[model samples]
Target: GIIFFGSQMITRDWIFNEFGCKFSITIDILCTVVSNFQVIVYTVAALSVERYIDAKLSLTLNNKFRTIITITCIVLIWTMGLLMPLP
Candidate 1:
């Protein structure tokens, strides 16, 4: 967005021709989708904890491997996010 906005402000138009235009558009869409998906991921995580609390069950995430699970989730989320914008 900053790149697009600044370029347009300086030249009053897209200076990068057709291919650059498509590349930039693809990048912009990917960033937007990834950020939106991150929000969804966090929301789901919160909901899972909430559901566990409501059920009066021991939190499954109390294990020593929780950090590994968290990292794996993040990596999968980003991988999906990156793939989602491709043709």
Candidate 2:
């Protein structure tokens, strides 16, 4: 995210060759997508679900179950985030 914003700020008045420009733009887009959608959005959702489970099923939910659930959510979030850009 910082890289994307920094590149934008630095490139405002500068110019790059064809390959450099394309590579910079690709990095910016990839960073923006992963930072905004994958990390922030999905993480919040996962935390919310975890909290809900903890609150509602505190007695039944053990550390092992919670760990499994958390890992599954993380994997799903990354998988969805990465696959979303694909056709």
Candidate 3:
């Protein structure tokens, strides 16, 4: 995200050709979308934990199950992030 913004700021006149400009914009958009989605996911996770504690629910999970759930959530987040940039 910083890379995209910094590049644009440093080259206000656009040093790259048309293709470069388009590619840079695409990357910027992808980064922005992914970061936004991550923020949403993190916020939800935090809220879920807060609610769970408030309700005094069990927070226990087997190691394997926890790993699987974490991996699945990461994959889903990235998949959704990448798909969001599509036209």
Candidate 4:
């Protein structure tokens, strides 16, 4: 598979002290890619919640609490996405 070769290349094509970390990276990529659908679902859920907040009330989104909460949700979603994999 393309993924397998790409992962193997990182380990085989380069010399490093990682002791075939590329293999781990390959597996991680496969796992993460396969798991991405779930991630997208979560993202859509977050967006839906945001939409509900925007429609549920009459006040414009100028209040500190609403603004902060919206920003928090957005940031949390992205942060988790970025940090989803670690060894």
Candidates in order have lDDT scores of 0.69, 0.75, 0.67, 0.68
| Global CA lDDT computed for model 1 | 0.69
TM-score of each: 0.55, 0.60, 0.52, 0.50
Residue 17 local lDDT, model 2 = 62
**Clash total of candidate 2:** 0
lDDT tens digits, residues 1-87, model 1? 557668989999878778877887787877788777865876588568656664784455464565566677677766765566445
lDDT tens digits, residue span 1-87, model 2: 345447668888535567776786787688667656766688898899888888999999789988888899888888777766554
Best by TM-score: 2
Q: Give the lDDT ranking, best first.
A: 2, 1, 4, 3
Clashing pairs in 2: none
Per-residue lDDT of candidate 4, residues 1-87 (tens digit): 344457558877644336456665777777578457546866899888878887986386767878798788777776676556433
Kindly report which residue pairs in candidate 4 clash with one another.
none
Better of 1 and 2 by TM-score: 2
Off by over 4 Å in 3: 1-12, 57-87
Candidate 2 residue spans exceeding 4 A from truth: 1-31
Question: Between candidates 2 and 3, which one is better according to lDDT?
Answer: 2
**TM-score computed on alpha carbons, candidate 4:** 0.50
